[model samples]
Target: MPGPDLKRILARATSDDDVALSETYVWDLASLFSYSPSASQAFALSFTRRFGRTKSWRVAVKCLHLLHRLLRTLPSDHPFHSHLLRSHANAIISLNPCHFRCTSDELTIFVRSYALFLDEALFCLQVTKDPSLPPPETFAKKVEEVDQAVELVSQLQGLLDRAMDCRPLATAGRSSIVRSAMKHIIRDSFMWYATLWPRLMLVLDNLFQMPHRLCIAGLDIYTSAAEQAGRLEEYYDWCKRMSLCGPYEYPLVEKIPQIQVRAMESLVENMWQLTDSSSSSSPVTFSSSPSTLTVSESGSSNCVETLKNAAINVEWEKFEEEEKPLIQFGQECADWEDLLEASVDCSWTWAPLIFDEPKERSQNNGDNGLRKHEANLQEYNPFLDHAHPHAM
Candidate 1:
């Protein structure tokens, strides 16, 4: 297709005498966009670059309107759509409102174009069932599309900075663009596309540090999530590491102590099961009082019959079962935190623990004259507090 009409029109439009009027060139360029899958950037670029340079504000408005009209016929799958849209936007925006004489109305062209592109990018994201699990090509394409929209939004943020500096009226639109772009960045990185914990942490780290108004809302939600999951302690620790540590408005409320206590109680209750099985195999030896019992080992016999203390008794096999999993989990965690309420038992910092029980004090045996056991809930737990830095 030799496009004789296009060539003839361009020849006339470019003639030295006709340089002042670009209206004919603008309308013809919009028409050129309708040419199907083979639309070339050269014509669209020429239209935007040439017509947008009109010295008259009214003529610039006309050129902007022409670009808008061209937007209507943009085929859904236009091969050059992004390039065309971006070029058109830059051309109008380069007419930077205040000093260069390009009016605020030209900005409307960019706003509309960007809104369309961003909306389409969001639509594509909706189809991706799992962003992390998407096929490689599909994933890359979707991410690239999102990145492009985010980049455009960044431009809007810069525009807002300028608008605030000189043109207050342009501030609202540019602020809106910044907010919209920030939302997309958050949604794509944390809400929809986040597949790994580190990535989610990264988003939180950025949000916690950003002074933008949007970040306040983001942090509010983030704090609520951490509170719900009982990881506020660890979460804020990372926040500090990223230099994004903010005032932790939420109080650290933990149900972990209660949960841990309940688990220990359950293990104690279940201890009888193992004891019952072991009783037949291992003979029990008793003394007048466990405190007076002495271990008289004649050889390296690996068996130690229970020397039951007058106050407390422990099932060794059952305690091992209950603590082993916690020990393994802690060792695997690689966490150096002094206190992680959620997984405190999984801390590997503790020394090799063989046995643990609360100590007891007998107060003259009272009137009964028999020994009594008083277990201190907090002051005398014998287990090593590997999870607490102060304990170490």
Candidate 2:
């Protein structure tokens, strides 16, 4: 139920000629910007207000189908052009106020078409990739790619901004539909960012200071939208789910601070274990300690390495597999679970002996006390206070 422009665009597009097809494609793409649920409701209201439901409802439904078909053809660089097609498709959802009569068949077609568009867009933005794309040629090339990726992301952000700024065409009863469309537009935009930013980080070699900025921008968009839309709980939950999977393996150590290193380490480790459980039947757990610890033998002192090596060396398939459980766990934990649950699972069989003791006590007791303390927190707390103020 768009204005005359949309109808004209569609009419010209569906004509039996190449010009119509190409025009249809571009028109469809442009129409994406206007096709929010809210906007549709507004359009429907405008139509109904001027021409009564009986006269205008069928035309509105027809417009929806034409828009859907047009959205089905957006191109992408990947083999699965369907991926790109979906992004625009999701934008064409119907808003509340029942644009036309609510027969089950019509509603089913509307929902199916809208859902298909969303799925296609989500897949294209998050899943479709050409393995054959040339790797970054040099550090500079990597940086440039990162910059380009950032620019593309910014363009996307601008589109959302415009969508939010537009006035809905309907003035009265269809407000909810207009709002729903706006929400859909914003949500899809954020989802696109979530899917693409991480991949861009992987492709870029040396981002210099870009990753930090990108992360901050992403976090800002997520936080702001969640807060404004009263979706903070859902947003946090989604973030937790996404982080558990550990999206990309850019050399983040150089970009993030040391204090944040442990947090990132836990996330990375959890992600790794989650992704590659077969590598070690026992889950990989992280300890809340620096890399080195102390030990004792024959009344002599020794140093032991407690930190696992901090490099990611996993295959992409394994990473993807592990990410699912973590994402699911995050969703489950988001509303009720403590934030720490999202951290690395630090429960290891041997960690108490190696890293959970005072250096002096470790030298004398051979880490026996540390092991005993882990089994009982009341004992561990008292022992830790007396033996390892530095460790605390």
Candidate 3:
């Protein structure tokens, strides 16, 4: 059980009136418990209420901070753990053109935070011990809830799609909101795909192994919803804009194109093979291959080959393009190679923790006792340091 001091800190942390609690208080409260079902529920409710009422970008940021902190203390089996998870799923549903106040910065924060939360939750659930505590049935229920949320997101996305297809709205904020909302929807969709891809693949594998065929119409709900919402073109435009933003920018920009290319290639190959096998024994055969057959076969092969060649060409062209001289441009237009390099290198300095072994166990038994003692001493040292600056 946590001490009374911890309860006090948590009360202050969750209070709407004091949004600027100290970082130390936040960290201490988070470390006190391995999991807290009630705390998780309280945090979710507070975040939803605050976020719903505020148009402030700061509110979104604060909500994200609180969410991240709450999630840090929640284990998958905790009663209210799913509540926080569902809140995120619900966010996608609620991020509609009507509900979302679309500032670029705010939308970016929301999408990023949403993605991070889902990623962290999935990771914790997948990697934690005692996975049976949540049970498969409970997980299935959670997934169904997520599915409903996805439907809502698709509906919201459709609105943005319609707005983008039509002429710009007469109102000042309306068109901008629609465009920004569209970006957010596309981003959310991509994040959904990223988060669900592994689980979907596992389901597909199970279906392939089972005696009975799997009916996956429910899986296509997102697609149908997007089509109904009128956002297919908007989705495409969003992807195009993301690609044009840079050559190799953003966390998963490279991944999106790669996944699409691989999926398209696989579909084309499978269809072509099926067609070829069917045509080989057909009664009616033309001297040339059927037009549909030829188009499908040739188009698939040609497109893939062309794309591969283009990738090689682009690599060579990048070097040449970087060397070309240009007329004097403003400071804002200056090349940021140095800045980019510095940032990338800085990331590498922490590679041990980020890229090293995912888990490690301490081998020194002697050190464990010492570590415990040190922790106890540190815990009480805060009080001892009240009268001495150096003691702190």
Q: Per-candidate TM vs. native?
A: 0.25, 0.27, 0.30
Per-residue lDDT tens digits of candidate 1, residues 23-47?
A: 5564675566556334445555455
- Lowest summed lDDT across 10 adjacent residues in model 1 is found at 299-308
lDDT digits (tens) for residues 1-392 of candidate 2: 34565445444433432221233445554454344333343333332333223322234333333443433443334322433333225443333223344344434344333433433333333344443488666544644555555555444444434433332332311333323333344454455545544543442222212334443343343333333333323443443343322234211111222322333334333423333332332222333333322211211111001212322222233355555332454255364344466446534333455456577876998678777777688545676677777663
Count of clashes, each model: 1, 9, 1
- By TM-score, the best candidate is 3
Candidate 3 regions exceeding 4 Å error are: 1-26, 31-37, 40-56, 83-392
Identify the runs in model 2 with alpha carbons over 4 angstroms from their true place. 1-58, 74-131, 151-215, 218-392
Query: How much lDDT does each candidate structure score?
Result: 0.37, 0.38, 0.41
- Candidate 1 lDDT score at position 17: 34
- Show the colliding residue pairs in model 2: 37-181, 38-177, 38-178, 42-170, 86-121, 87-121, 96-177, 274-322, 275-322
TM-score of 3: 0.30
Question: Tens digits of per-residue lDDT for model 3 on 1-392?
Answer: 34455546644554444234345655664555445435544555544566566665444444444444444444557554566557657662133222435466535444344434334433232322221244234434534434433434344333333323322223322333323333433443454444443443333222211111121222243234324333444444544654422323222412224433333333233233333344331122112111222222123235344435444444455556665333334546456785565456542212354543323344445579679999899778766677676753
Tell me how far the alpha carbon of residue 122 in candidate 2 is from the true structure, in angstroms, after superposition.
Answer: 16
- Sort by TM-score, best first: what order? 3, 2, 1
